[model samples]
Target: MRRYLRLYKLFVLQYLKTLMQSKLDLAIGIAGFVISQASGLVFILLVFTQIPEINGYGIDQMVFIYGFSLLPKGLDHLLTDCIWWIPGTFVTHGGLDKFLIRPLNVFFQIACEKFQADALGELAVGAALVSLSIARGAAELSVLDVMLFIVAVLAGTVIYTSVKLIAATFSFWYKNSFHIINTIYHLNDFAKYPISIYPKFIRIALTAIVPFAAASFYPASYFLDRSSLAGSIGIAAAAAAVSGSAAYGFFLLGLKSYDSSGN
Candidate 1:
């Protein structure tokens, strides 16, 4: 266990070195993040202007959801963004050979390659929005609510990684597996809103299957005092276990089928 932790640290440090070497890329990424946040603000204003309340969720609630959604996603961009393109790059260029030859875990190595500086803006904007949402409203957070919020963010990160892994694993057969990743990310956008607004079938699918709801909605609901903490935690736990297991299993299956193109 200690050995594995050391390897993970080493892998992350190497990525940090690479990121530092490319200051221009990091600057561009940060600029893009700021633009995206400005756009989000405009979107929120437009949305609230039309609907006094959207399905019992006010603009403040929407802010919480939007903020929570971006935080983990940004962190994912920083840490595991490389996993997003592993499928196309590895299969097309036979890049998996490098991972296969490495002394450390391949997943860790792949994860380290994705070090996006845009995540700094994401983290900053997300935290700012969350605070603004809570403070602007009369809603007060108890200790338990804060704890549940933490769990939900952790769950969100796990779900994001699982989805990316599943998408990348498809490269074992389909060289264009990044399309699958794109689709998942598009669907995950709904997590920026309350899942209750969706049809019952869609809600059920998201809560029990893909579990975009568990990542943001559940915790947001808890913060709004509309759901039970126990139930939300239970669902998040189940989602994390099932989705993560499925992703790792797919990766293992893909590993067995890996054939280097010697590129």
Candidate 2:
């Protein structure tokens, strides 16, 4: 574990040096992400203008949910999103062969290759919206609530990372499963709203199958007092543990099946 951490630190430093060569590009990417996030918020505001509320959630509550969703999603994106490229470019083009020759874990090597600095925009926007919601009295949080919120965010991030890993792991067989990975990931957009507004089947799929709701909606619901603290936190923790274990197991199975292009 110490060796892996040292390797990751070196990888990060190299990536930072690479970023320094293209400062303008990095700035532009961050600006673009900020604009995109702001546009989504604007669309939500327009929706509230048309209706008083959706499924008993006011605009502030919706914004809080939306913002909370981004915290985990952005953290996953920042840390592990390179997993997405595995299916298309790495596997198909035999780039993964290099990782197999290295001493470090392949997944850890992939994760530390690059950090998505642009995700900072999402993180900043999310924090701002959550603060705005609290300032406007959308929800009042106690000390316990704050502590649980932190745990929930970390657990949610684990869920997001696990889902992505599972989706990408299919590349071992298909060689190019980018579409499958993208489709699975796009489900996260639904988590920005209350899951109650959806049909029973959709709700079940989101909560149990993909479990995006555990990452965002359920956690936010707990924070807002719409659900019991124990139930919400328990579900989130269980989902994270189950999904993470499943993903890691599947990844190991896939790794055993991998056939390097040199073979």
Query: In terms of lDDT, which candidate is strongest?
Result: 2
Highest TM-score: give the candidate number: 2
C-alpha TM-score for every candidate: 0.92, 0.95
- Worst lDDT 10-window in candidate 1: 225-234
TM-score of the candidate numbered 1?
A: 0.92
Residues 28-102, candidate 2: write the lDDT tens digits. 887887788889999999999999988888999989998999999988988997998888766777778888898
Off by over 4 Å in 2: none
Please write out the lDDT profile of model 1 over residues 1-263, one tens digit for every residue: 69877877886787778878888888888878967875887798797998887888788878887887887777777778888767777776888888788787788778866666678888888888889989988257779778767777887788878877887788888887788878876677787888878899989888877787877777667777556766776677678889989998888888898888774
Q: How close is candidate 2 to the true structure, as a TM-score?
A: 0.95
Any residue pairs clashing in model 1, and if so which? none
Candidate 1 lDDT: 0.79
